[model samples]
Target: MRKVDLLDELRSEIGVVSDKCADQVNDLYQFVCESLQKKMPGYQWVSIYLVQDYAFVLRHDEGERILPQSIPFGEGLISVAAARGSMVRERLSGRVEVYMPFYRGHHLIGVLVVIAKRANVIDEEDVSLFMELASLFETKVEKYNS
Candidate 1:
């Protein structure tokens, strides 16, 4: 499917989930993680990490490999993205990691990390879509937290 189509589908689904489960932000995250992982080919891992006090706690994820449950501030790429309040994209030999930060108003709140097995799997368009997705996630977060 096209990237815009995928995002539209996700946004619609997230709207439904938001209407039904407005207080359960984790469920919304889970739906997004699953939908993106299944619909978007080449995505090896899709995860959302929410800020909890001093660290980022894993909220929802869908993938084959295991990942850390939490990451502290100023530690890893995820934290770097959050601290910088911007998206971070890293391309390695075989994989590409995109970390898109989410915020509550002006304060950083979380990060959405997408990992693809190959560097070519993600491009500029994909990053833009992910940024929108992250914004949607942030909106839901604020909706539920308010």
Candidate 2:
């Protein structure tokens, strides 16, 4: 939204972060989700789903509503996004859910789900920003996991 100008700042916020946890990748995911929700008020919920064992496993989430901890490979919007390797924007009754898939090389890493309380909240610029965020998340995850 209007926070587009905060791109560099947001990037820097997530780029140089390192958490001392057993599961650092998930910790980074949680940090990114929190940062997104705090910086973008339009995002009522933010969650990271890692592709593990052919399923979308919920690594971390920061939001008002609780979500499923896991989704089967071919069950829902996450599956659709993963299949296409692109962002899937869905407008529901009261919210707009954007499922953005990111990768490490040709391998799909995970999906970043951002939910806004109002419909039509995601636009072209937002999509671009989300892609950048997903790339940053992928880089951080790769570095941490390796």
lDDT of 1 by residue, 1-146 (tens): 77778767777876787678768777878887898798888899999888899998988899864458988888889887977889999887689999999888998878889999899989887887788778877787788788
TM-score of each: 0.87, 0.83
Candidate No. with top lDDT: 1
Worst 10 residues of 1 by lDDT: 13-22
Prediction 1 TM-score vs. true: 0.87
Model 2: pairs clashing at backbone N, Cα or C within 3 Å: none
lDDT score, candidate 1, position 32: 79
Which one wins on TM-score?
1
lDDT, candidates in the order shown: 0.83, 0.81
Residue pairs clashing, model 1: none
Cα error, candidate 2, residue 109 (Å)? 1.7
